[model samples]
Target: MTIQIKICGLSTPETIAASADAGASHIGFNFYPPSPRSVAPELASELAAITPRSLLKVGVFVNPDDTLLNEAVRHGALDAIQLHGKETPARVQEVKASFGLPVWKVLSVETDEDIAAADAYSSVADLILFDTKTPKGALPGGMGMGFDWSLLDAFDKSIPWGLAGGLNSENVADAIRATGAPLVDTSSGVESAPGVKDVDRIAAFCKAALDHD
Candidate 1:
């Protein structure tokens, strides 16, 4: 029950309220416009202000330049920045320095070779998020697709990492048991539709994540 649960891609006030009510430890705001879940920085700021201090705020981006990241930090009270793109270790260092916020580096995992990049980010990332790789023509993360759980079997990683992609109320515990992830993330998994978060599903997902610990 010690694992952290992050409910990503929250847009509406109703869902934001449900996120804390459901006992989620963290809430994520997507900055990528292409994503159906994307919310404006001003709207994110409004949501963050109302969010309980007990819930941490995470800002998601995809290889964004410094300007957009700075704007999010200035407007939305983000406690962490989730780099869900092809950002290098050097960029990770730069983001941490420039924003003065804890940085999370997300690595799309498909095979054992993908785990090698973990070492490269180990020294800099506050946390490493392992998301299932997107299809040939899809967004990077939050594609509502999952990888084989056995792929993460016996993954003895040195850095702290989270498991994401296609995880929901039914499969989160099994995913955690297989990957030994210290954290669990959700987006489309808890949605009634694309970008629409379901409060009940959010609660169920959180319960499953906590039970795994």
Candidate 2:
């Protein structure tokens, strides 16, 4: 199967270009203010301007209100919406109806129950993203923490899905081998610091993900 890739939490034009050049299928812009990777709507627009149409621009938000989603969609020109917060299935439906964009609902997985929770959104969510659950009072995602890939073995695939959290060049191929993830996403894995993306790492990661058989 062909594997798709997403480089998340991108903030700069240089990294955005690098991601597209390296053959990424999707690029994410974080809109949550508390996270270090957060970007303003104007900055996201500037970065989106340089992005190629072949690549999808996904706006990442954490329990965002309509105001923030409105501004982000209008200014960022997002192609998809990734809900990385505690939004219910009803909220996911609301976001889809309001934005008229593909909605990817993130499920924080620690056990089979977490994986099973995706069923509630099978109807509304365009995509189901499995991520590692973070601690309370901490950032929701992009923390570079990975869970047991084996847990996904029990997943019923009731809907289309992708894998995220702690993926990088050195292990992305293995991740693909282990999980057969249709799409793989990463954020802090390609960063040199908290929110600083490393171009070379981005290239290597894309190469690894694409080269895997």
Candidate 3:
């Protein structure tokens, strides 16, 4: 099966172009202030216009209320909402109902046990993002930390899941092979530094995912 790729944490228009030109299926713009990659809603809107219609624009939020979420969707023209914080299943349903777009639920997985939480969102989420769990008091993701890929060993079920947190050109193929993840996402992995996306690295990562084993 073909792998879907997403380049996340994009802040500027140049980075958004690089991701789109590199064949990314989705581009993620963060609204969380805690994230160094965060961009203002106005910038997000400007960058969103540059994206091709074929590419999906996703807005990342952290426990955002209706006003912020509405403003974000209004300005960014987000095709999807990625709730990376403590939004419950009911919240997910509300966001979906409100925005009328696909909603992605990001789950931090450390062990096989964490996979159980998927059930809570399976019905509501259009897609699930699996990322490495950070330490207490830490940000939700974009830490560049990798979990044991083997921990996903027992997760073989329906729903298209995307692997994230620590993936680059070198390891993405292996990550896909190991986890059977149909989609792979990267933020810090394809960057020269946190929030600084390397254009060449972005192209290389897209190539790596499409190349043979």
Candidate 4:
């Protein structure tokens, strides 16, 4: 089965190269400043420059406005925009229209009700991402928190979607099997520190996801 893997919150050249070399389908750059993985547009641009064109470059944002998206898209050379915040369906459409890029809205899930909320974004977003809901006063994502993957078994996945939050090499294949997620995203799972990605972990994650059948 060829599970698509996205290694998110990448900042350094070594990690970026590791993700690409490890056969990740997508690479993400964080634009949210509060997170340790966040990077400036210029720095993201430099990091993104080394990525091959075949690999999709994603820019992660938190309720971003036009200014932030524009700068990040231009400087980071993003291929897709991931809105990991409380963005309305209208906001998702607005971003798609404004940037003319594929927009991925994140659905923070804790209950079946949360998973069902994805329907509201069905027509607006090109893709939907299921991530663990962060605790109050905590950062939006990349917290290494996860919800019950079994909840997704009953979800009506009408739109293309992926899984995120707390996934690692050891458990990613199991997550995919439980949820049947075609795509899987990870950040802290492959990191040695808050913002530092471990190359070996990155490689292991890709191998594990791909080897899942």
RMSD of each: 1.4, 0.8, 1.2, 0.9
Task: For model 2, state the Cα shift of residue 5 in Å.
Answer: 0.6
lDDT of model number 1: 0.87
For model 3, where is the 10-residue window of minimal lDDT?
151-160
Candidate order by TM-score, decreasing, is: 2, 4, 3, 1
Q: Mind giving the per-residue lDDT tens digits that candidate 3 earns over 1-213?
A: 887899999887777788778788998989998898998899888888887886798899989999999888999999899999988999999999998999999989898888778888999999988899999999898888989888776665577688996898989988888888888999988889877889989999999987736
TM-score of each predicted structure versus truth: 0.95, 0.98, 0.96, 0.98
Task: Please estimate how well model 4 matches the true structure, expressed as its whole-model Cα lDDT.
Answer: 0.92
lDDT of each: 0.87, 0.94, 0.88, 0.92
- Measure candidate 1: CA RMSD: 1.4
- Of 2 and 3, the candidate ahead on lDDT is 2
Query: Model 2, which residues run further than 4 Å from truth?
Result: none
Query: After superposition, which runs of candidate 4 have C-alpha atoms over 4 Å from their true positions?
Result: none
Can you tell me which runs of candidate 1 are displaced by over 4 Å?
Answer: 153-156
lDDT by residue (1-213, candidate 2, tens digit) is 788999999999899889989999999999999999999999998988989997899999999999999999998999999999999999999999999999999999989999889889999999999999988888999999999999998887656899998899998999999988999999999999999999999999999999988
> What's the true lDDT of residue 69 in model 4?
96
Clashing pairs in 1: 1-213
Which residue window of length 10 is worst by lDDT in model 4? 150-159
**In candidate 3, how many clashes are counted?**
0
